[model samples]
Target: MATLARLQARSASVARQYYYRNSVVDVFRKKENDAAVKIQSWFRGCRVRAYIRYLHRAATVIQKRWRGYLGRQHYQLIVKLAYYTMKMNLYNAMAVRIQRRWRGYKIRKYCFNYYYLKAYLKAVSETNEAVREALEEFADMKEREERKADLEKEEKKRDYQARKTHYLLSTKQIPGVYNSPFRKEPDPRELRLQKAKPLTHPRPKVTPKRSASLRNWLECTRARSFPRSAVLPPIDRKPCQGPFRDIAEVLAQRYKPLEPTLRVAEPIDGPKEARAELQRQEWTRNVQDKLFLPFSSYHKSKKHIPAMHLSSKYGPDSYGSQHFREKNPERWICDKDFQTVLPSFDLFSEYGKLYSKAGQIV
Candidate 1:
């Protein structure tokens, strides 16, 4: 009996343990299923909300487009209405203008003419008989005055003719020199009087030496440092072998001419050198022409005639002349510096253009 009881108790404990474990597993499974169900419901809800939002956005876009279309239609309608109204107003104003002009023309042409004619007729018909008699008397008086003027003119003409005929029939006497009443007759001896010879006086002849004596004396008396012969003695120095002619020569030799690397083609002393060369050539040409050319050739070559004296104030190429500086400041003659000096430029040259570049003239 003891053994059976122990076995039955052990079986009952095992059954209870199994029942507890099964209940615990069931509780855990139900909780997991509930959580899964909740998550699925939340996901579905989110999808539905997203779809609703999408529908709202699509509807908003459609509504905006519809509103824009309607607004555009309204705007077009308003524009058409305004255009038609403006056209109608313009036509009406034109019609009114035409009507006004037509009415004014009709009134002026018909009514003014009729009124003027009526006034004129009334004045003519209301005229008095006394005025007509007075006008007739005035006309008769004018006729009588005209007739009197005509008779006076005829009398004057007859008197002129009678005077002319009487003068023509009368005899005229001409006065002779001997019988003239204006002057007494000259004596016969005075008429034969001989013309006396002009009085003679001798004029002393003057010598050139006498006239220039004072000038020569003054020149002799003036002081001098040395004899005139020693003052202008010619030098035998060769070209480019003398002392420096100007500070420019020194600068030219010191600062080399600009190379072709730069756009500026000339150096600082280039203009000075060019001007000096031009002056030297001009002087040489003038000297040659004066020595070799005939006197008649001077007129043609007179452009480079040597000046008697050099200007003391300004250099040959300087432009500080008071006469032209103010009048033409931009002209090369009026420039303060000799920057515009060109070696080969000539105002009289015919075989050149007004502008030149790179040996090509345009």
Candidate 2:
């Protein structure tokens, strides 16, 4: 009985121990599963945050690049606008300068005209006053002489009548001398007639027709030579002096047919050919020191040619050789290894030949 009871108790104890061990293992497994689930959730959350951060960073970089591109484009547009504005300002300034010069020219012309007219008027007034005084003196002298001649004729009337009758009959063939009233008249008692000396001087001859015609033409030419103020007014006693009507009149006659004013026309745009020529000249100058001088120095020393001949052929600065190479590079080749292999000949002759060949090809 004692052996049976001890075995039963030991079996129960073993069963209880196994049950506790299994429960503890179950609890450990549940805690471990919960920890694993929490860990996995945290890991997943971290990956989502990392992905969001990466997206935000990429967006910021893209926005910054876009803004920079836009800023550069706006800056370029502003520069172009400024350049155009500057060009227009320069054109306006040139136009203004031209207008100012034209205005100055007009003002000078007006001043000259005003002064010249004033001087001419003063000269004309003086000439007129002198003419008037001379005419008045001549009139007074003529009146006195006419009265003396009348008194002498009255005193010798009778004598003069007798002499006149005799003289008329002797010198002329009268148609009816006997029936004339003057033949019957008696001479005045106080008359004492003096024999008149034969009138030697004939009536002043009238100008020939041809000479009369030329008089006007000569007067016109004379008038053109002098200023208008120099000419005197026509007076009965003396002829008018000098040529032309006045200074103003003379100037008007001379200038009427000419253009009144001049203006500068706008400058024409340069031709494409001319622009190309300018560019070519600029390019030639840029390369001249670097290329032509070195080539010329090498050619003169190596070829044993006279400096004068080289200068004549290539010009003082080897212009011909450089020009030839620039215009027709295909005709002349330069080896990379050989720095002094330029053709040895008169530069002018070589250039002439090349031009002739080119002309023929064209």
Q: For model 2, how many clashes? A: 6
Once fitted onto the true fold, the runs of candidate 1 whose alpha carbons sit more than 4 angstroms away are: 1-21, 112-362
Q: Relative to the true structure, how large is the alpha-carbon lDDT of every model?
A: 0.61, 0.59
Q: What lDDT is reached at residue 188 by model 1?
A: 31
- The local lDDT score (0 to 100) that residue 157 gets in candidate 1 is 68
Any idea what lDDT model 2 has?
0.59
Over 182-210, each residue of candidate 2 has an lDDT whose tens digit, in order, gives: 55542332122224222234589898553
Clashes of each: 0, 6
| TM-score versus the correct structure, for each prediction | 0.26, 0.24
Colliding residue pairs in candidate 1: none
Error of 2 at 211 (Å): 99
